[model samples]
Every structure is written in structure tokens, then in C-alpha cells.
Target: MKQKSTSPWAWVPTLYFAEGIPYVVVMTVSVIMYKRLGISNADIALYTSWLYLPWVIKFAWSPLVDILKTKRWWIVVMQLLIGAGLGGVALTIPVPDFFQYTLLFFWLLAFSSATHDIAADGFYMLDLDEHKQAYFIGIRSTFYRLAMITGQGLLIILAGFIESSTGLEPVEFSVTTQSTHTEWVVPQAKSVTTGGENQFVVTQADVVIGLNKLNKIQADSIKDWAHKQNLSNGFVIKEVQLEQAPGWWSSNVATPLKESLKERFGKEDKSAMFKGEVQGNIAAFGIRLAQMPEEGENVVLNLDRQSGAKDLSLVEGHRLTFNNQNWDQQAWVLVQADPKLDTAVSADFRGLSGNIPFAWSVTFFVLAILFVVFLIYHRFFLPRPAADKPVAESKNMLNEFVETFVSFFKKENFAIGLLFILVFRLGESQLVKLASPFLLDAREAGGLGLTTGDVGLIYGTIGIIFLTLGGIIGGYLASRNGLKYWIWWMTLAINLPNLTYVYLSYATPESMWIVACSVAVEQFGYGFGFTAYMLYLIYFSEGKSKTAHYAICSGLMALGMMIPGMISGWLQEIVGYQNFFIWVMICTIPGFLIIKFLKIDPTFGIKKQ
Candidate 1:
């Protein structure tokens, strides 16, 4: 084998960055995809969740990858395959209707990504020398964290933008209903008949509903299903006159004047004028015809006058039948009816000019169209970052650790590799899985009641910087001292992030700033603690089939995340968000116990000898 001096620090960062990405994409965002695609929340959690199975169970097959192929071949093949999968995802993302197909596409990508990890880690061991590997440990860890950040952070932002802008069109919509009530308040006409002394009844028809009954107990029939409903039946039979005459006395004088005319004038005397006040009652309910001719079919209102009349000479009698001449304003029908029968009323008319306000419609239509156009070009058509990374030589820190990364995955240290995988990414995966329902659920639902914007800020902006710092520092410490020296310290760092959620659950702070800062601090601990685990894997995978060994480690890591995540939704569903975070804290104890097994010499990062 040809030997040349190489820098381990140079490649580790980007390599690990590459390592973390596919898992986040396949596992995490897939959950998000089904949700936005209109899948029911429960179905989104259940169906999309299956995508994690490949990673959880990938460990069993990782050995085959190690024993069979060149690390170089596996790396390139898996990378190309992932690239193809991403392209497929872009194509298939159009229809939220097909979730199963989309999830299958993602599974393909995960399979490729896991295999890539196996091959890529192996390539690292074949390439890097021990001294350089030790020095570059921090560098590798940083890049991998960046990859995770990019998957969860950047991709999510893009998806959100897409979701907010798609599928809107031009149409008109609104709601209008006529509220009606019927009441009889002492007829309001100054005792037209004696009060309660005698019950007057009229000759009825052949039990048919009559609409023209004025002297037949005059009242509005808009009340309800009763051909013989009792009077004063909760129906407010009242009228509101908008404007009144010049003087109040004019109304009273007119009533007296009417009596004088009747007394003075003979039965046949000629007098064209008659005076009276308009009684305020439920303004006659009858056919209200529009003043103008309707756009289409005709409207007709007919009156059946009393053929063998006794006396049709009452003012209320006249009001019982009305026809409006104004086409625009409808004529009101004050006809009385037996209020006991169910009256079948129909408007017998059609169009409402559903032509909404033209200017508003145009404005919204333009805004929607422009928004869709911008995002479609930005996401699928226009190129930002090519979604997936290319398989190439990396200058990241983990790149240097490639040599020792093989020994980390040897069959001899299978248990350690599994442990590191299971415990290392536990906090990150669990937190990511748990945060969604808490933020999106309503306040009454016993959550903190933050908006999507709040979640993005707390988990995204501040967490980014602190997590970067922690990862960098932890990576540096592990590289400088040794795995044993820093393993427990890093474990403490990672597990402590869970406590922030505990604090958040207990303290329902109003100030978003306070909540945001707390989340960031916790994420920082995770970043720092995660670095030691990455270094250990690299250390163990160094000797033979480094990439295959690393892939096994990565598969175990996926299992750690998948199991907790699968049940996390159920837990939140059961105990609610507040109690769930406390449970997460309880789970952290197991991780700390596992950390006790890590054996790091004091001078571990300084030299591999």
C-alpha cells in the first residue's frame, strides 16, 4: 500500500456531516411530509414513521456490506443512489395524495445512505494516519452536525414556504341568513274586541292551509309548524317604523277625527278623505316582489278575494294582501294563516351575482399566483443547494479519523459500537421527534401555545450557534485527551439538554425570548456531548472495513432514535406534552449508565500509539 502523509482533521467534519444527513431526511422530514400532505395527524405519525425501520434494522446487513465490497465502491454507489432518490422525491412531491409511494422513495434513499455510511467510514480508515486522525476528531464531528442542521432546519423552512403558498384559486364565498320570529302583543290597536270575554271562531276550509285570513285572528305566520298554534306564542309580532310624523298629537287627533267623520257624514255622503294611524304590528308577511324584472324566469303573486263577502272592510284586511311595484325592493306579504301546519316556503328564484367584488378578487388572485410561481421556481426548478451532497474527499475533521474509524466498528467491539450508536444520538432524535405536537397543538390542549414561528426561532436560530460551539469544544476535548477521559463528561453534556424541555414543560413562560433561550442552551449541551460519540466510532472503526463497521454503528444509532420516536407520539397522545418531557428526562438515566463503559486514555486524541 502506498503511504503519504494526510491530515485527519481536514475530512472528518464534512464526512460526519454527510453521515448524519440521510438519516434525518429519511426519518424526520418524512414524518413532516405526510403531515403537510393532508394525511390525518395520526396517520402521518403512524405511516410515515415506518421509514425509520431501514435504519433501525440496518445493523444486521451492515456486516455483509463490510465483508463484500470495497469501501470506495460502496461510498460512490450509495451516493449516486441517494442522488437518484432525491430526484425522485422532487418529482413525486407534487401529489400529497400518494403518501405510500413517497415514503417508499424515502426508504430507498435511507438504504443508500446507510450503505454509504458503511462504505465512507471504511474509506476514512484506509486514508488517515493515527496522529492526524486524533487531531481532526473535532473537525469531523462539526461537519456531521452541520449536515443534521441542514436536513432538519433548511429543508423544513423550504417545505414550510412551499406549503403556505400552494393550491389557491379565484372564487367567491360568503354567508347570509334571514332571522325570523313571530309574537302577538295585545294587537296594539286599542281594544278592537273585548278582552277574553268571548272566543270568536270562523268557518274553516276543508282543513287546508289558508294564507288569506285577516279577521280570522290577524297575526304574522312566520312563527312555525302549527295550523292552530296558541296566540302570544313567544313569536315577537312587532314592527319598527323608521321615521315618524311631525307631531305626536297628530297621531292621537287622527283617531278622534275618524270617529267624528263617521258620526257627521251620512251613509251615502260623499267624502274622499279618511284619517287613521298605521298600527305597529309584525309588518305583514306576504310575497315581496322585486321592483325590477328578474334576469331569467317570471314571478307571479295571485290573490283569492272573498267571493261571497260579509265585510272585507277592515284596515288589517287590506294589509293581509300586498304586492310591491318596486322591482329592486321586494313587496312584503302580511297574509295571515293557521299557524299549526308546516308551511313549505320556496324563493322560486336563482342567481345572486356571485360575482364578488372584482377589485378584491383580482388582488387576491394575483398575490396567490405570484407566490406559487416564486416558490415553484425556487424549490424544484431553480437551484439553491443541490439537496444531496456528492461523494468526494472531505476536509472535515471526521475525514482524518477515517483510519481509526474502522477499528471502532470491528466485530470484536460490536457491543461498544452498538452502545455508542444507541446512546450518542438519543437526545437529538428524541427531542426532534417530541417537539412538533407540543408547538403545534393549541393552548387549551395543554401545550405552551407557541406559534410555528416561535418553534423555528427557539430550535433553529439560537440552538444553531450554541450546538456548534458545544460540538466543537467536545470534539476538541475528546481529541486532545482520550475517549475515557471525556466520555462521561460528554454524556453529561448531551443528556442535560433534556432538562431544558423539563424546565419548559413546568414553566409556561409568556415571553417567547425566555423560552427560546432555554431551548438553545439545551441544544448546546447535545452538540458538545455528541462529539465524543463520533470520535469513539471513528476510533473503533480504524482497522478493517472501517466504512462497514461505521455503518453498523450508524444502524444502531438509527435504532436508538427510531424506538423512542415511534412511541413518542403515543406518549404525547397519552400523557400530553408537559408530562412527556418529564418522561424524556427519566429515559436519559439509561444513557448515562452506558457511558460508564467508554474507555479513553488520557492522551487519546494526541496520539494513536
Candidate 2:
């Protein structure tokens, strides 16, 4: 008796949707999360880009899926594994050392997702006949694109929402200080206040300043004076009340102090100062104190002479007091202040906020539940076809692997083809790495300064819809006119629209419309152009063991994306976002050059009509 066939409609959409999720989460979503968490562009690009390893080498293990269990079994198993991996990532994200720990789960997701791709594609072939396969191919592509929306767009939008609700803010602050000094004297005392509380509380009442004529102040005398005054190495300025400390607070607060000292004392002054005194001063006293001036309250320091010059009182001590009730509780950090210096000290800390960790836990928890749902739905609804005989015995596994590797290199124009595949998306790979970061970064930092939610609305939701539309239109056009005719246009589509970034970086437009339109245009081009690359991979993998060969092609595709992306952050840092985008456009030359030698069939992708 003939076996009854299952309808493709029941499972095809969900199958491709499942396939799209982990890949997007790994490749795209992780980048955004890291960027938002303030991981440097270089580290984010390098570390996350390494997650692409599994997809690049996945072709090496594709033969195992064919040789071991049935494709259906592998599909279900891999789906469950992917779900576990996603949950692992979500769980680890809120940890103290989340970057390292979360990366481990991302690797797991990447590898499992790649394996699922192999099995799912194989199962598609085995479960459907030629006519049904052709009929549902578009449907499969559509659902996969939907998966992109879900993963890249909807999930990111979800993350952006969670970010808003969770109360995660970048650690940053700024302080503006002004002082009244009639004569230029070295900085003697300073105090910092935060939220109406004295943070670096300096007991100015007991603080003393020693002032002597330059000729009377000898080196030995100064040393003896420092010792008698209980200045052990120097005064220790403690950070008393830290309302919101940024990540780099300790390292950066002293930077401005050092700069101020460098500006004040020339080379001669440096030589006259005690050995390592500059460093010691910075280490001992780095915190700045600023008190906003009050209308009737003038904070003044009055010094009274002791008895005579012989009383170890070469300098007079002053008691400085201020009424705290009249002062506003805004953020004010005091740096150097002189009773006579002409310059004012200003300290600004950007990207600092409350230390509240956003509610990312909820996002991941829901995702885990969603994956469980996917797992249960697939298990019950997916058809289990009769298992095909394993293609290789356990002993032949090594030989089959060798054949799979060797045969790919033996293809016609293989070297040129490989080069084309590798460089085709070189620009795009780098662009995608920093796209979210460029959007979320402050406008002063060469970004659009969009909020996390705004990034989701513009790039994820609006941009992805156009991307999906572009894919559909590209498919229709390729079917009508064939892949060969549209190859050049597709190549242009992939590379040219990177100009949107270049434009955004230059204009730094505040209007959301400009940003949204720009993202839409670029994403649409990406979707439309990507069709050629996919069709080309299919064309190249048409020979013996086409499935395995296609797997190899997919590996190359991943490798292409991986290598360029790994260095994109460092590159962006070297040349700011604006120039980095220009460099991306420049890198597209190789793709154009390689495409010249490709041998495509004129009618390969055309429809029967």
C-alpha cells in the first residue's frame, strides 16, 4: 500500500521559522545586547563573530547526519538541542560575568542551529516529491523570512521593550564647577556633593594651607613641613557617598586631574616636584567636589595666624563652612580649585546611570517557553517518514568525510567560485556587525542616538517588513527573468545601499522618519540581493551528493560573514563609524571583481511559463 503524504502547509512554515530563530538570535540579537551592555565595538565584533565558527565548519559534519540516524530523528533532536541552547543563553545573560558565560551558550546555539539546517533541508527533500517541493519552495522561503522578522525584528523589539521596563541605563554623569579666585594659588581644597549629600566630604574647618615666600621655601623645609602636617604621602580623598558609579569612574576621574596638572606644571615644575608626586597625587586625590553657589551663602575659608614663624606654623589654617540646606541636589563633582587660578575645572561622565539590571530574565524565560511550545508542536504534528538506510557504515564515516571535503574543491572554477562566495557579502558582514550599535550610540559618538525601543521600531519592525518584501520581489523577478540577468543588479543591491549608513553618520538626523527610511531601504536591498547569492549556491551544488555540496556552500557563506565581521569592531574603532562605513563600501570591490568570472546558466532560475 502507498503511504499517505503529509501536507507541506502543516509543517513547512514552522520548520523554516524554527530554523531562522536560533541563527538570528546568535548572529544578530547577541550583537545588539552586547552593544547595549557597553561592550566595546572591537570586543563585541571579535567575540560574537567567533560564534560563527560552527556554521562555517558545519559542512564538515553534514555527512554524519546522513550516515547516523534518519533525517526526521536528527531534525527533532537538533530542535530540542537548539531550544536548550537558547535557554542557556537567556539564563546566563544576567550573570555578573555574562559576556564569557553567555558566549558559551551562543556557541551551543550556533552549532545546533547549523545541524538543524542540514537535517531540516534533507528532510524536506525526503518528505516531498518534485512537484510539491517546487510548489512549496516559495512558501518555505517566506516563512524563513518571517523567522527573520521574529528573531531580528520582533524579538529585538521585545528586548528593547524589556530594556525600557527593566531600568537598565548606561553609567554616565557630568559636573560643571566654577570658582572665585582673585590670585593664582595652587589648588588647596575641594569637595564633591551628590544628591544633596557630601560625597567626598573634606573637613575644611581643620584643613590648613601653608604659604611661604618662594625664596624661603627650601626643599628640606617643604619635606619637613609635609611630615609635620600629617600629610602621609598626601591627603587621601575618599569617595564617601557614591549615588551612581559608572563602570569607568575610578579610571577616568583622575584623567582630567592629570591633564590639569600637566597643563599647569611645565617640564621645570615636574622636575621640582617630589619623585612620582604627580602619580601619587592622582592616586591619593582623584575625586572632584563641586558645590553649586547659593544666593546669600558664600562658602569662604578664613585663615588665622598661629603665634610666630618659629611655631611650626609657616602656613595659616582656615575653617571653611557652608550651609548644605540651601544647595540643590544635582550631580556636581569638584576637581582642582585655586584661590587664585584663572582656569575652571570641569568633569563630565557620559553613560552612567543606576545599576539596576534590566528585566532580561523575563524575555529569556518567555523565549524558553516559546521554544518548548515549538518542540511540543513539532513532535506531535511533524510526520515521521520511514527511515532511509544510513548512507555509510560507521567505519566508512572517515572516508565519506574526506570525499565530501575533497569533492567541493574539485568543482569547475572552484578557486574563483570560492573567492566569489567569500567576498560577496564582505561589506555587508561588517555593516551588520555595528548597525545596531551605530543606531543606539549617542549622536555625539557618531550614531543616531536612538533609544533601544526606537531601534526596535525602526530597524527590527519597520526595516524587516521591507526586507521581507524585497525578498519576495527578488524571488518573483528571478523567476520571471532568470538569475543570470539579475545577477549584476543583485550584486549592486547588496553593496550600494550601505550609503544609507554613510549618510546617517554624516547627517546625524534627529527625525525618526529619516532613520526608519534609511534602514528600510538598506534592508530591502539586502533581502533582494541575497536571492542571487542563494540561487548561486544552489547552482554550484547541483552535482553528485547535491545536499552535501549545498551544505559546503552554506559553510562557505558563514565563513564569509564570520571573518570580515570578526574585525569589524576594531576597524570601526580605528576609523569612527562614518569612515568605517566608507571602508565597507570600498571593500565591496572584490565582490564585484570576482563576480566577473562566475559561470551562471541563463535559464537556471526562470519559471516554466
The C-alpha local distance difference test score for the whole of candidate 1 amounts to: 0.50
Model 1 C-alpha RMSD to native: 27.1
Query: Across residues 1-609, which tens digit of lDDT does each residue of candidate 1 receive?
Result: 543433444345545665687777777766655533334456666666676666666655665555543555555556556656665665555544456666667788878776776655666555554444544555665677677777776766554334323322111111111124334322221112333422111121111222222222243243232211211221112233358655765567744664564455313322112111111122222122223233542222212222221111111211111112222222222222222112322111111111112221232233224334322432332212221122223434354345334455345647755776776665556677877556544445555766444565666677778877877677566666766777888778878767877776677677777777777777788777777777777666544445556666666666677787875765455455666677677777877776666554455556565
Which residue runs does candidate 1 get wrong by more than 4 Å? 1-3, 6-53, 83-108, 129-138, 141-432, 435-446, 540-546, 568-583
For candidate 2, lDDT tens digit of each residue in 348-436? 32221112134444566676677788788888788777644456666577787677668778999899888888999999999999999
> Model-by-model lDDT, in order?
0.50, 0.64
Please give the clash total of every predicted structure, in order.
Answer: 76, 14
> All candidates: CA RMSD in angstroms?
27.1, 16.3
Estimate TM-scores for all models. 0.49, 0.55
**Among these predicted structures, which one has the highest lDDT?**
2
Off by over 4 Å in 2: 1-7, 21-53, 80-111, 124-389, 393-395, 434-456, 502-512, 569-582, 607-609
- Model 2 shows how many backbone clashes? 14
